[model samples]
Target: MRVLVVEDDQFHASYLQDTLAEALPEVTEIFHASDGAEGEEEARQGGIEAVVMDLQMDRRNGIEAARTIWAERPQSRILFWSNYADEAYLRGIARIVPEDSAYGYVLKTASRDRLRLALRAVLVEGQIMVDREIHRLQKQGAAPRNRLDDSEFGVLLDLALGLPDKLIAERRGMSLRTVQNRLLSLYDKLGVTVDPEDEAVSLNKRVRALNRALVTRTINVETLEAAQRDLDAWLGGRG
Candidate 1:
């Protein structure tokens, strides 16, 4: 597989390239570009089997790059990787390849293993690996706000990771009540203006949605597209 990586951050770009090389040795060569502008140039030149690009870049940005690449090389698959679930990231992807085909998206923090799995699945299996975090957060619903200090954030993430409050307290040195109070605050920030009437019902819906998304190897492409464009506008200072 010939891989094209487009990212602006120097460290992250190198790390991504190295991760792919170490894990996917079957890949014959890797082509790297600094930002969306150069990425578009490289894409126009062709021969790329897959593209792993940052959705945000200095000059042109990932969305524009993907749009350009798609116009030039429709056969080439793209495995988008980014840190954000923000709007800019979504819209960047919305413009390119219809979600029915060989394209994938994974978050930046996804383990090297998941990244490789997503890449192989797309390049070989013709499927997408929606980031597990996407499933995890979407399962519980978005946090109303990210007000947790690092410690509180850790506790919140513990909930996302399915740790019980008692265990979390034992692990983090907080009392069980303290843990519960913090969680209530976290839920408040997450925008639950009303009390949760049915944890079971909400959990059931989330479980089914996430499971279907994974097993079907698909995702909310439409939502992602809309969000990305909105984020871009904000980042661009329009909002």
Candidate 2:
């Protein structure tokens, strides 16, 4: 099998290549790309049976690169190795992946044996494997059929951006009351409660809710970044 290891860190990339070569004797060829752009270019060259992708990269993020690669070759298997199990990263992966394609999500901190296991699972056995920690967080942070639907998640993003309810409503084409109701639902889902009598608790409920969602891995940096990009585009169009 031919494998491509796409990682910015030279040491980690080398380690993965060496480990895979040693563990999988059938792996005839292994390629390396230091960044996501290079990875995309190499992927375009073809003959890549499986990819060990890093989630974050300097020039182009892994998600962006993976989206392009999968768009062209939906059959290519991929194993995501990253330090973060951020909901943003997971959501990004969940959104673009082709149906019926095998994939794995394993942390960089995973043991070498575990990494090898994930590689074999996705690359050889065509199985989906997610790190236990990340899988647990995914379940806890989601309600049945998605604890926070897209609309609620949108409201959470607006609140996380520190937008007023009116602005959020205007941006979402929702009434102020509807937006406020969504915010209340978000607070409930995120398990954030505010006490009107507690004068000593100085933090605003919205801020607290956002922070709690972040701390609990219900929301993450990439999610905020994506939301900010959308807002910027919206503002630019309005201008």
Candidate 3:
């Protein structure tokens, strides 16, 4: 099977290529891309059966690249290899993945055998493999009562970036009232709702929610960085 390894680090890319060659004889031909944009271009060329995608890249992230690949080729199998199992990354992946698609998420620190197993399972056997840590975070983020939908997550990102309601509405192309509603939902999920007894302390729900998200590991440096990039792009487009 032909595989594409998409990673920004040349050493890691080469290492992955070599590892796959040594570990999996089924991976006959391996292609390499430096970043997500190049990876998407390579995938678009149409011979790659599976992709070993990196989460963070220069121009586009693995999540964005995977979304485009799955959109064009719904049957494509992708193995997300990254150092982080951040909830933001998990949520992003969960949001765009085609229903019932075969995918895998393996951390960079995983053993060589583990990586080999993940690749073979997802690429050849058509299975899903998520790291244990990632699965834990996924479950925590997917709790029934507090799970934040895509809209709520987007609003939470905006709030974390200190975007006012009006600005968020403009950026996201939603009505002001809709943005507020999403904020309310976000606050509820974060358990930042105001209590009559604690009215003074709970007055600023936005700040409380942001704090809660940080404590819960829902949003972190990577999450904020990604959000900032999107916000910058939006601002640039508006100009």
- What does candidate 1's lDDT look like per residue over 123-179, in tens digits? 656775567775565445434353335555455445544467886786668999998
Best by lDDT: 3
- Worst 10-residue lDDT window for candidate 3 reads 133-142
The segments of candidate 1 whose C-alpha lies over 4 angstroms from its true place after superposition are 91-95, 139-239
- Compute each candidate's TM-score over C-alphas: 0.56, 0.76, 0.72
Cα lDDT tens digits for candidate 3, 52-95: 99988877778878888998988899999888767777776776
- The better candidate by TM-score, 1 or 3, is 3
lDDT of 2 at 53: 95
Clashes of 2: 1
Cα lDDT of candidate 1 equals 0.65
Q: Give the TM-score of candidate 2.
A: 0.76
lDDT of 3 at 8: 94
Arrange candidates, best lDDT first: 3, 2, 1
Per-candidate RMSD vs. true structure? 15.3, 3.7, 4.5
Summarize candidate 2's per-residue lDDT along 186-225 as a digit string, tens digits: 7888778877899887767898888888887777766666
Better of 2 and 3 by TM-score: 2
lDDT of each: 0.65, 0.84, 0.85
